[model samples]
Target: MKKLDYQYALKPDWQSDARLEKQTTDNQSNIVNLTLSDNTGFAELNPEQYTWLLSFTYQSTHKKKSGSVCVILENNEQNTVNHRQYFEAGETGTRYLNLSGLLADYQTLSQWQLVYDHCLLMPDATLLGFKKPDIHHGPILIIAPHADDAELAAYGVYSDFSDQVWITTINAGQNVQSLDRQYITGLDDNLKDAVSRKAKIRAWNSMTTPLLAGVKFERLSSLGYFNLTKNTFYNASEKQQNDSVCPELTPAISRALNTMTLPNDESNISSGKRLVDDLASLLDQIKPTSVFVTDPEIDPHPKHIMSAHALALAIQQSGHIPDRVFMYVNHLRKIKKFPYGPEHARTALPPWYESTSKFGHYSCYSHQLTLKTQKEKVVSFDSMHDLRSKPRIQKMLKAWWHKKVLKSGYQFYGYHHYFQTHIKANEVFTFVDGKTFSDSLLQKE
Candidate 1:
């Protein structure tokens, strides 16, 4: 068989891991059996020395229970690290899930073994890539709702093809919640967004940009009712009412114009016009061969939805004709029990329970990545904290890191679970033929 080009293939450790062991279903019981050399239950293991596929068969009893099979490591300090693989209810037979590949760094490679709890429970699990990924030939636009969206959702693809990518941060990332205290204090309404802008810029420069290096980043950030609000676009009915305004720009547009630069100036322009014009111009100039946007249908965040809508409109108006347009899932929000893990390196992406792709001309593909690519993805997060220059940003990341790596407990598990589980797969997109994307994306339920 002709092999695929994967960076991890060249790793000495991966070479040792080339052979895999497969297990058949246990005829004796309805229960799923964990196959391991440690029938004694504790075989000495090294992440580098030991790499094997976790095999499982889905019984009707399982009925589509998809989450993750975690690989947990405990050091002498008793700190824990997690790795997960998600499975859907219907998957069956001997499947290859490599848990040892979870150890992505040298610091994590030393003197460690799987946690008794994760191994003892032995559970079950779950591709996207490109066709002609000479992504550098034309352009690949990464449209992000905020500064960090690209890093969080599409970092692997961005990191691999940095020079070919053009990133556009669509909205001002200033968390309006942070400005609440200032607002009640009678601070000038004008300075609220200014403060938020400064705060976000400080973090972006110190944390986000450096963490995701070698990419061209541009902020076509919008102002006005678009400040930290969801549902920024007017649906068909609302469009008929005001023509230009999205009646529900947010919780309260009357709050104050806190924007720094373009808020007041752009106020005269409706969000729809600004959204169309700004992105249209960007598409015209970049003419990306591949464009990646947030999947409007799945990401429940309002801005995420609106940003997707904006990208659709821009593509429609620009007349640039991109070869491929992709969408991905949100890591933080677990939709209808969707497993949170790394992007899958397979072809043909899966459809969400209610993906809106049917409404447009779109085909999807899931890209499976090498274990090495997944490791680099995790290291990228740490690099931000270690190299960050801003005290405030560094402090924030430090707090988050402490929770993810230090505490084994947090809601829906914790960031530790997310990052560890995340390395296994990724969601990716590709475009379909002959469909006119229109204001349909701007419509409501």
Candidate 2:
């Protein structure tokens, strides 16, 4: 996990002179900056400490030019392990490299690098209309379907404007149907009992969620909670006394997988209406300048779509119109080629949404981060492991806490992928053209 640092890459004096020359030319308009990151950590590895390469994606920007890259690995230690390779890139696209073998060859290597001279692009001139950085104003509000989504999608925005933000978690944060407790083996004897009990614990962990909101402006009251998932509502309504609910095991979203109808449409819609009224009232109270929600129209996840439906209806029903609304993506579209980051935002729309929608198209903007904000983002991401308020939650149910989130939890599918997105300098959002969300669209079809 240990790898070389671009800021302090080890090089011979001649190479240092070359690096200075490269830097001097990079000051020109048409240059592709070559750098390295994702040091995959050094153990006192007897010089093999930081010897590893991750097969991951990285991007470098250029003045709309074509270029090739060359990398060199050298160990300053007594046992020299040196190697070199070449790569080609078009314009400012992403390239994925697997240097595990290269690192393995330099077992006792001290440092490595992307060879400056070979990192060249040719037959390229200039690109017109590069966008300026995205500027977001406060007080911003983020609405997330599950516990870690807000952080995954836009931690840069949250930390940079933490003092001027609020968060609302629309789900109870329990992926209940995914209730296999095998990972807790030896940690708990009564896995079934622990599973049932863990739902409430997830809700409790959720209460302190907004603590991750921002350093300065986000307050406890700035956050709001609503657990509207189909499996469970923090508070349930039993209208028609005889209304039958789905068996507790069924995921609520599964009721209508191909469409967005709530289960037993009449019955659930009644429940949805109650939710609509409550959310409308809350929106009226908050009167936010902007409302943030997940993409419902095309996001394949039903709970997310349902949340969006409910939100649009609430705005329609409440008669409270915010100046703007922002839509963030999760789960549906094929993720852009670049995964980890020097850049955080994506500009593409979901193919399905794009092909079918009358709205046509919209722009993408990135609320790029500062160095301080980037550090705060990494710290905020790492804090997910700290288990704050551990005394009470763990004291009452240590086994569930250990297996579900902390010790053995990375096995959960989305765990690693979610945090990896933060290794960048920006976060992106699709700006839904406001005119598309006109009054008519807010009303029921």
Candidate 3:
């Protein structure tokens, strides 16, 4: 691949001309105050090997300030840089040099320097070599709306990349009562109770069987409560009653209904902050190169909206956003309300459903079957119900099935069935990491 090199001057501006103060200083480090300019120069080295270098300058007030200057980088895509330090500032001077790395591993030399106190300096002093940007290859973390949302939305995609698919549910092993409780108690009391008493062993067995068979199953919580249905009100009185009783829930609910709502708003601000903190911690641990989240605009469900906000906040807080953040469609069954109608609807269909003519039936042997067998094995070992009693076994079976259906992969069956039986759409948002690519380059040649 041919390397591309470009540079622009960071014009002296009002912000860069602001007064500076020395907060602290040491033999090795110095903290100085200086405003940054908006006219920062950006360079794109290559399309495939996307690399960028941003340069700007700030004025210092401290005369003996001779330590390294640190710079932090951030972008809309959630990419960020930890404090990058450069030792280019001269001692006993008001002028401080600002130099930092944006994409450090790329195969091109892109530099920015501080030119006077207000102006930004280019790489006229020293030449840096071009190096290839690091390629990310890791597992994809899919945040499905419900239990089975992953299999319905990206079963084929997961199949295509089975080795790299790590399906996880924001909520898992949920039930109608537990859903009711979240609307009421906002706690995972049922899950804690079940686990404590070991009451829902059959339920857990059935729900987790399919996932363990092929994909890694990670459950955020077994409460399985969704934030969607709780937001909808049948009438004015109901809405008013909810507002009076649970005013705290109104904001998250409102954000779900209103797509234009930003994550920083009052309603989602606290939750957003918590999510950012949590995500920053997760990013430091997982360090995934790419992430998949539901699009809050398209996904009207409150849980989906919250999850999207959380993902965005997490990436921003991490200080190093992944290479890509893909937005997968969550609540496709609600697509009838979309303005584009038929044209937009087609984008939401799964690959299998998109080409029904190619496959005979949607059913395939999976981990779910294994779970059913496990349930029987457990019942036999515990003798929880008499094997000879038909009614008793039938009741246990029903209970087990219900619990199994609550698992992440099984919950999507309801929506998948709706699409298969009714509307046909499978649109999903795929945010590519690195520089944006043209349509022609993305398309198969």
Candidate 4:
């Protein structure tokens, strides 16, 4: 397997308008001041229509073994924009920061400063010309590996074009230990009963959250596979001979899987062969113009990657063609506090650790959201039962100390709070046509 830096794979081609190279001495530690050689592009560049990004090639000098490193851009008025991202020790590569929010007009950008708290500039390059992507229309089908995934990754998308959307979740049969503690039967409920209740709650959450986006309940469906079981659905031959042992037979799962009436046989939800077959079946049914799935390679979650693998297998078998396929990264290779900064900040390009010889199999696009739409996205996340914060008073007190006394932001707290990473001013995706997606993504046996 081969891997590539995100920048070369994602960034649009641009002729460098200007360049800078230097280092800060001990007296000038952590700061570099520079003037642009040309400001003519500023007049034509509107932050509304374009994404203004400053690219930096730098090496970190900080001694921290692991965690995110911070880079900041400060204007003449002392206002600053910062991006903190994960980095390996001594790693060197080009990183990007979004300047859209900080930029108002050409007049205000006469002087700017670069601040690297623990990094030293290797070389500087500015890429000035790129337009924000327009929202693609649908008949869109979103594939969710787990119940909360669609809402976490693209609530902004489905919420924006709700009537044109259909959501199909792969895993609604979850056994949440957290739900076990919430005594539904007043102490009579055992593990099996608790798990059934958990499935029902999440199934309801998946069905209803999209309704707020204007997607009718009928447009949503679940495969009802047990949570985190997508990775096991690949061996079609093995599954055809015998039924899987852990089947979701609960009434709640049946209701979630079938829209009009309940299913009689457990085969649909119980069999791995059935899961793959049903996915292809939906492809033929929806005939979606655009489809969204998690990037199998870039997303770190095993179930998420397996979900993409299943989609690839389904497309190969069904031969149904979609106009576009969008792959989004939610976990981002285990980087917890990515899309970093405050929750409301606009997303920039994700960080890259090194340049790659390979480039351009897929292009990156950002789905910019209007403020009204962003608010609606928040409402969708808040509505999901799984996203609700559980009581963690001890963890909270430690976090309070981390933020208040120690003065380090509670950076680790957002690790599991996906809303913090995903509910931003925009969502990003690596995009390819359906044909390329099907041809390129061959599932591993």
Candidate 1 has a TM-score of 0.53
Q: Write the per-residue lDDT of candidate 4 for residues 160-264, one digit (tens) a residue.
A: 778888898776545545534542435434555566666677777777788887887888886665433444664442343221322434333535545733232
Candidate 1: list runs displaced more than 4 Å: 1-84, 88-136, 178-199, 202-211, 217-225, 228-270, 331-338, 341-351, 354-357, 360-362, 370-372, 379-427, 433-445
Evaluated against the true structure, the overall lDDT of model 3 is 0.33
Q: What are the per-residue Cα lDDT tens digits for candidate 2 across 1-445?
A: 1121111111111110011113234445322323322122232222212212222122333332222233343442211111222222322322222232233432322244443222333222211111222234535656666555666566766666667666555543333333343224344355444443443444333334446553332232211123344322223533211112122421222122112222233333334455556456556655656566776555657677666666666677666676666676666555432332222221222223122332344333445456565555555554543222223443445445545655522121113344433444445454443335434244334
For model 2, give the 10-residue run with minimal summed lDDT: 8-17
Model 4, residue 434: distance off in Å is 1.1
Order of candidate numbers by lDDT, starting with the best: 4, 1, 2, 3
**Per-residue CA lDDT of candidate 3, range 300-418, in tens?**
66777656655554564566566655555545443432211111112211111122211111111111112233223222222321112233466555444644853311111122123
Q: In what order do the candidates fall by TM-score, top score first? A: 4, 1, 2, 3
Task: Check candidate 2 and list the clashing pairs.
Answer: 1-40, 1-41, 2-40, 2-41, 66-121, 67-121, 162-214, 163-217
Give the C-alpha miss distance for residue 215 in model 2, angstroms. Answer: 6.1
lDDT of residue 442 for candidate 3: 20
Per-residue lDDT for 1-445 in model 1, tens only? 1111111101111222121122236433222223333222122333333333333322212443333343434433322222444444433333334443344443453332322211122243211111223455777777777655666567777777777777666654334444333423344355555444434442443234523556543422323224323344444312211211223233113213222233224334435556556677777877777777776655678778777777776677677767656666653244333343333322113223332343444433434456566566666644432122233565556556646775423222223333433444443444432123334453442
Clashing pairs in 4: none
**Residue 346: error of model 1 in Å?**
9.8
Q: What is the C-alpha RMSD of each candidate to the true structure, in Å?
A: 12.1, 15.5, 25.3, 5.4
